[model samples]
Target: MLTENVHIAVPTAFSEDESLHIQGTIDHIRSLYEQGVKSVLVSGTTGEQHSLNLQEKMELINGLEQEEELMDNMEIIFGVSSIRQKEAEELAERIRPTKLAGIMLGYPPYVRPTQEEALIYSEKIIQLSNKPAILYNNPNRTGFDLSAESIIQISKIDLVVGIKDAGSKEKVEHIKSDTHRNDLHFYAGGEEELEEKVLHGYDRLSSIAGNISPAKISQWFEKMLKQQKVTTQESEEIEAIMGQVYQGNAIVNVKKILNQQGIPMGICRSPIGNV
Candidate 1:
């Protein structure tokens, strides 16, 4: 069971030519580990995961496996989603033997499957991966919303631990009320409108801004979870952080900051930083 309340959704480092920088990605993860970050999600939406081919993702998993200390120390969750179900299944099988802690299972993009089809996809991947799973619902990107009823049914599976960006407040409430399990976590995708999301029952965080300041983001999110008030100075500091991150193209900003700090995060794939 994955138990971290907040996990950094770290971006995948690419070289100057936009090839996967496996070592650079690991280097960033190592830096985060040293900075007291306890958990991380790799190849997530922030990682430009869809841009990565199956072979590239497999290579990344291979690279991650070499870092025994990092894997042992951090709760590493990998994103597993592809436009093709067969690829997803193959990826799940690939992840089954690794030391990765869990998977963030996202819906197929563009080609929206019916709820029943999505359910089958979810179940098959979960069973194959044999690890804890977090259902990722990003209808804006995937063009398929995993309905609250579908989520409620999926939660019955012990391996289905949580849901990320599970739609509006009312939908979250509906799912929460319908489900009997208390361990089902609701993870806000990023820090955007997080206070409101927390107020609406989001207990966990899949944090994008944490890539730049893991400790600070974790501290802020913990306070938010507790509904504690932020002092004026704290608010100013947080506002500054948000300004730096959320101003434009968050992943691009993250890479720029990391590269400036000499972490070799490199550039995002084409069109992401084309501006």
Candidate 2:
């Protein structure tokens, strides 16, 4: 269930303290697609979407849809996270006008609950949207861990096709092992290189590093997909450079590396607070 292309997920693009030029966001995504990104996700945590107001989020999604270039081959997945179900559903409905490919949702202050509560939340989103759904389970940020059983149960609905696995190795293994034969697809989040989840056997990868280091990141991702291993030296350089600040938050280092290579990734929306 590999729902995205280019195998990278750039989370937290705009920091709260920073100023976001609406045109800047669209240009950034368009540039990535031209660089060979098959799919691009907007308004996720990486996009700093939670920090945006409801109207702002709508504007962003609508803007992307209007891009004739984006409407062609690139798949754009909009983040649908909200403090309440009604607001979330409203966002989903708003997305109907755009050709948004998918919607991703995770925990929020207003909807914290046990697995059953989460299941209901997921169902409501699926029924409300025409686009596919991505269930984000980054417990470190979301507070409550979304159980694999919860995901599997919810995934029974056709819309919930993918899960962003941001849990620890043990948790990931359980879900991967459990869903070995299911229709549910697992999306590897964060530092895919550091974790080696791709090396260990996950076929699909979602790298934030891909933002700035499109060519290099794509090379490694393609290599990994092909079962080819980069030298420890090559891998180490990537990690040391991208594993820290100034690139795009945790991903800024990666952006720095890319900037060195001649890409136009200006800045990470600025201040980079709490990336």
What would the per-residue lDDT of candidate 2 be over residues 81-155, giving only the tens digit for each residue?
776767888887888666777877766653468888778878887777777877887766667788868876776
Write the residue-wise lDDT of candidate 1 on 201-244 in tens digits. Answer: 99999998898988888998999988888788888888889998
Q: What is the C-alpha RMSD of each candidate to the true structure, in Å?
A: 0.7, 3.7
* Candidate 1 whole-model C-alpha lDDT, 0 to 1: 0.94
lDDT score, candidate 1, position 232: 88
Error of 1 at 235 (Å): 0.9
Query: TM-scores of all models?
Result: 0.99, 0.81
Q: List the residue pairs that clash in candidate 1.
A: none
Q: Against the hidden true structure, what lDDT does model 2 obtain?
A: 0.66
